[model samples]
Target chain A: MANVLVNAPKTAKRGSIVEIKALILHPMETGFRPGPNGRIIPRNIIERFTATWNGTEIFDMEMSPAIAANPFVSFFAVASESGTVGLRWTGDEGFVVEERVAIAVE
Target chain B: MIARHFGIGLAIVFIASYALAQGMADKGGTDKRRSGTQDMGGVLQKMQDDDTANPGMLFVQLGGELWGKASGASGKSCADCHGSVASMKGVAARYPAIPKGADAPVDLEGRIDLCRTANQRAGSLTSESRELLALTAYVAHQSRGFPITPPDDPRLAPFRARGEKLWQARQGQLNLSCAICHDDNAGKKLAGVTIPEAHPTGYPIYRLEWQTLGSLKRRLRNCLAGIRAEPYAYDAPEYVMLDLFLMDRARGMMLESPGVRP
Candidate 1:
């Protein structure tokens, strides 16, 4: 398992903002880099990330090659009626990494 | 509601960006790029800082599993003989060291093969091997945060002396010595990139350039090639000698094995 670490308050007041932090393991390889033989290494990077609250999309964005390896992304969503907050990163060759954490609203 | 949500998300983005920049500046030192870990480009730094995000952790995790697996004619698992892996702290830092009765020093990789053949009766794995790298990284990971200490034994004198000479010796058509850049001009700009002091604080590091974990020899070979010189063979003694010298020279620096480098 490419370890994914995420932090979200276990309990939150309804309608309050809940911050989420996520870091995923990845090379985010850019094709512009040259190999030891001086050959250009093919680009391979996470192209998109989406965050959802119980199937309802809260935030999503397109990621480019410049984001760096092992991308660390943070975003906050209103703790409306929480179920599961999920983050998904889709990359080259249809690679997808997803993590989900549940939050309870008081 | 949607607009407010977007506003919070935007603020988070701004915070993340600020943290990213601040992380580099947070490293307090005259030279921020002293270790290989600090030399990483922006993205690579994030990869190395959080273990959850580093791809090299995959190998380290596998190595943890392999540590206790029995193999070869001896049917012995490494753990059976070595006991708790946690006890191995600070051992990797002392390697490329001379084993008892041996005239030459053996780096971690070499020692792995020695254990396999001599103790386990297992066949040797090839250089830059998946299993070998994983095991080496796993073993070395235990020593993370320990200082690299060159043993003061008199027997190691000649090899260290040879290594010292090689560091300053000019080579290749470019006729460049390792000192010219790594020592003399370290921290200065060269070809739009700041020259690093060439510390070996990390080894079996994951270089974004190669996109894989490589031993110190590979990095040395790269330097040789950069100088337009013929690189040594993978297992050459000269490489080992140079590695010994480099490790000793960088003694007392923190070990950051399985590091990420740009």
Candidate 2:
């Protein structure tokens, strides 16, 4: 299973910015390293990452070999209300993962 | 030149362990603890301090996920029995414990296996397996700030002595011992890399060299290979004893499990 971890605050202040961090576990095999039998490992990496708040797109980006294994990304989102923020990651071999977190604002 | 240096280092370790073993028998690893990271440059140390950059955290995160999922015939997860990893605080500091009435001092991995097999009825994870490292790293991350306290038990007394002996014995084609680089020549440069004091403060760590999280046993095997010696089996008793002695030697030092090391 494509394991992903997301970190966000349980509560936030109205109209303030909150930092969100997310990471996905993967080898991101570069297809450069030679396998034990001298065969080249196939290239596999997350091709795209997207984040949304309340079903509205907040952030999106494309990735490639330059991206390190187990990619981690952090971004700031203005706190407007309480709801769930979700993220989606797409990668080679049809790997897809989603993670969601909830936040509350006073 | 390398062979000669190793011989000198071994001699120093022999004298150091002999003098310190008696005192360490009671004090644990705390007296003058230092981690290998301490000897590293700022960039590496900072990378370890920052969670996002510390690749080891990825494994810990996986472990946290595994803790809650039900598995095996028992249909239970680690969280089911050890609820709230918050309760796991400082638990790693006192481990490789000889479970009451048991003769062997199983490390964190062994303990995890026992729980999986006996309580969860889950399949055992082989040594150095990613899952095992993940779980061990997660459990160890809880004790991050706690000091190591290798148990001083009657059953462990003989094992500790044995560990000390093996640590001092010359081995491999090079006839070098651990003490050579870690003790006698600590703080010196070896082939452009700094020689650390060989303490076990941060373990189950992310090594830049290995590019993955590994146990101290893996490092020990590397050391054996460095000396051109035949390595013991993965589950060898010698490894266990050496682990015990290293923990004791590292007593009192704060743990940095799932640590990042160059």
Q: Which has the greatest DockQ?
A: 2
lDDT of 1 by residue, B65-183 (tens): 77888879999989999988897788889888888778898888898888988899988978888778878889999988777887887887788789889999999999999999999
Among all windows of 10 consecutive residues in model 1 chain A, the one with the lowest summed lDDT is A1-10
Expressed as tens digits, the lDDT of each residue in B108-223 for candidate 2 is 88888888988899898898898889988899999997778887687887887898899888999999888887878888898998888888877788887776789988999999
- Backbone clashes under 3 angstroms, per model: 2, 8
Cand 2, B chain, TM: 0.86
lDDT of 2 by residue, A2-104 (tens): 6766778899999999999886788788878899999998999899999898998989989888776777788899989888898999988998898899999
Task: Please list the Cα RMSD from the true structure of every candidate, rounded to 1 decimal place.
Answer: 10.0, 12.1
Which candidate achieves the best lDDT against the true structure?
Answer: 2
Model 2 DockQ class: incorrect
CA shift of A29, model 1, Å: 8.2
Model 1 agreement with the true structure over A23-94: per-residue lDDT tens digits: 666778878989999999889899999999999999898989887776768789999885999889888977
lDDT of 1 at A96: 88
Which docking category, incorrect, acceptable, medium or high, applies to candidate 1?
incorrect
Itemize residue pairs with steric clashes in candidate 2. B9-B180, B10-B180, B28-B251, B29-B250, B29-B251, B29-B252, B30-B251, B30-B252
TM per prediction: 0.72, 0.77
